[model samples]
Target: MGKPTGFIEYLRELPVDRTPTERVKDWKEFHHHMEEKKLRQQGARCMDCGIPFCHTGKLISGMASGCPINNLIPEWNDLVYRGLWHEALDRLHKTNNFPDFTGRVCPAPCEGSCVLGLNNPPVTIKNIEAAIIDRGWEEGWVVPEPPAVRTGKKVAVIGSGPAGLSCAAQLNKAGHSVTVFERADRPGGLLMYGIPNMKLDKKEVVLRRIKQMEQEGIKFICNANVGDNVEPQIFLKEYDATVICTGATQPRDLPIEGRQLKGVYFAMEFLGANTKAVLDGGAEHALISAQKKDVVVIGGGDTGTDCVGTSMRHGCKSLVQIEILPKPPTERAADNPWPEWPKVYKMDYGQEEAAAKFGADPRVYLTTVKKFVGDEQGHVKELVTVEIKWEKNEKGQFIPKEQPGTEQTRPAQLVLLAMGFLGPEQALLKEIGVETDPRSNIKAEHEKYTTSIKGVFAAGDCRRGQSLVVWAINEGRGAARECDRYLMGYTDLP
Candidate 1:
């Protein structure tokens, strides 16, 4: 609303990123900052719609349609446009505890549902969002605001990923003493290790927020794994309430032949080790390196893309990513209408890097790895793949059918499985006697976030299965709200 014709006048623009060829040499963040004037122009592109769908936060066709945390998109857009920098940050913090993380990582479903996207390109919500928070940090406006008075209550948050951080943050804001326990050597759980450093820098961005949370009086206990060294029952005994945000760490495995080869590794295993090496003064020699190797990534998702990017940084000789599903259409098909996530084709950062060197996209659609070929040392040397076609079975379920004469054997010294996660690891839940859904997730209702066990709550991927970081933050805040109500018999958290 800052400029009535802003939507019509401004075109979509994104911040320039480091070229794929040059950025592949190092692990630094590739995204660059846009000048304030250009950023305001991007913010002005947000149409002052009669009914904004950008923040509706609904699920359509089994995918997120808008901002999962219901971010005040229009308000912040206007604030940024009108040069009310502080006001914009205030509005962003009202819903999102970490705009910097979301702006960098979240897929921005809000853009898919933008009203302006019906005709023209949607507003540059993601870029403008990142700019606003980055500016706040540069201006020193972001600081810890610990609660004024303690409520004399204590809460324990298990895990320190996006959900755990947001949950602990909100619980701390409610004037309750909050403690977050993470099993990792460093905090941030998935944020710390699951994602590569290039996507979310640990020291600069993730840890910066962690330091602020420490200042806000939230205690983080690292290397305190509940089911192993630290007793799970201690939380039930020592804290008034407990919220489990341990996320879906159990990765899905491809149980194929030669899976036991020494060179084959889980996506998390590869990504986690590489990030640790990057942070620990480049001790990458101790960890597995894709340097001078022909790497094959099994599964096509963000993790697969991360593998490609990480391998490129390690100076891999070649790269290939295999996908079981067919390639997505270039544009939305007949069934994929507006307000739903657009199932279209777009190359991510990893593919960009791979293509920059290899001269083509590294992904091959409708292909599945048949088996891996290993050398005498039990190290993977090659993999055989076969093209497949989806066909309906008698039960009307589509299943992959191998296409004859389509098998191809390719060189592969390392293989990373990035299919996705199954659910949260079950040892701690079983140790605590918490019930789990059939899907192996914690049996907690949405919004309420309470488990069958009294005084126990669950949220994020642990409760809802594998999802985006924005959704995890949404669940974290929602779980904090319910936990507050349960403890105090009322709540004011939104």
Candidate 2:
């Protein structure tokens, strides 16, 4: 509450991003910086509500309603309004271990739950958050603060994504020797490989944080799969405690007709290979290429968007994204009121780029693949699709019902399955004999992080199923606090 009338005086504003056409040409971040005065004005829009739901991080209607890490929203808002960016960064770091990552990638449930959003637009909390951390980095305010003393205990984190990184970071801050093992060539599991570089610059943002963590005495062992390359039993013997943050990576498959076609690939396979080639400067080794091809991406989430963006960069001649669900309302519907995640339609970056090039939004909602029609050489040449409607089954379950006479075919040389992940791969969990929930996620209660076995802990997507980076950081920090408590008699970590 830097200014009492701030919300009344200022309208919400975000930094301008490069035009879609221009940004599609390169794999760099698009959003530019806002001037200090305008940024402070955006921060001032945060209403000084007596009950700030923006920071509550509660679940409403089975969806996250605010900052999942319970970031001190108002305090930082006030700090940003007062132009105390370093202080704002400090406050942000108090709860979220990686605001840099979240600021770029998070869907900002905080804005959805803002008190001001009941009528006016919500405050630009995400933009202000990114600004604070970016300012910290620019001013050299952020640095490694390794623990002053050793706890004489060792902990092993099995993933290098947000959860594993945050868990390793917090545990190391508690004076424990922490080691993170990542199977990828470099660290930052999904952050490094799963996501495209343009959305989150791998070198400047992700790896920079990793370098600081390394300087803080956290050891990252890359290209090491704990359950396969190394043994799970070895962790039990070598380390005093082991925290498994292996993310939910088992991608869902569309087992339709002609599934074995040459050009068909999992979304991760495409995204992962594209990122690897981009980083390694070896585009020739890319697993799949959308260049000069008609591409069809199946699904309509962030991953699907990534596929579209990546395809656009590869100079795909034509592209279409098929989504099984119906299109969302342009604005919040009557059933979706304030303080809940508004299930509304908003074109994301990839769709924006696709629309810029293709002259229309590429999504075909309420449609799904019937089967693949391939050429004589076994390459996908076209997709047979059918329109569908949601209908209640005998058991009162809503399922897709193909509408009669709604079948059609579209040319597609390459088909990328952007359907979401099922859960963590079961190999490691089964090898370690960890219990699993009905969803096939690790059977550990939320916030506790304890597995069925003593001295073993699980967190992140592996424990909670596929989720946002913000949620992963929340679970990671929570797991670290619990792990610290288990190792020592108490934990000072929040």
Question: TM-scores across all candidates?
Answer: 0.99, 0.99
- Cα distance off (Å), candidate 1, residue 394: 1.0
Candidate 2 vs. true structure, TM-score? 0.99
RMSD score of candidate 2 (Å): 1.0
Which stretches in model 1 have alpha-carbon errors above 4 Å? none
Per residue, candidate 2 scores C-alpha lDDT tens digits across 214-289 of: 9999999988976678888888889999999999999999899999998999999999999899888855557788
Candidate 1: tens digits of C-alpha lDDT, residues 213-252: 9999999999998889999889889999999999998999
Instruction: Tell me how many clashing residue pairs each candidate has.
Output: 0, 0
lDDT of each model, Cα atoms only? 0.93, 0.92
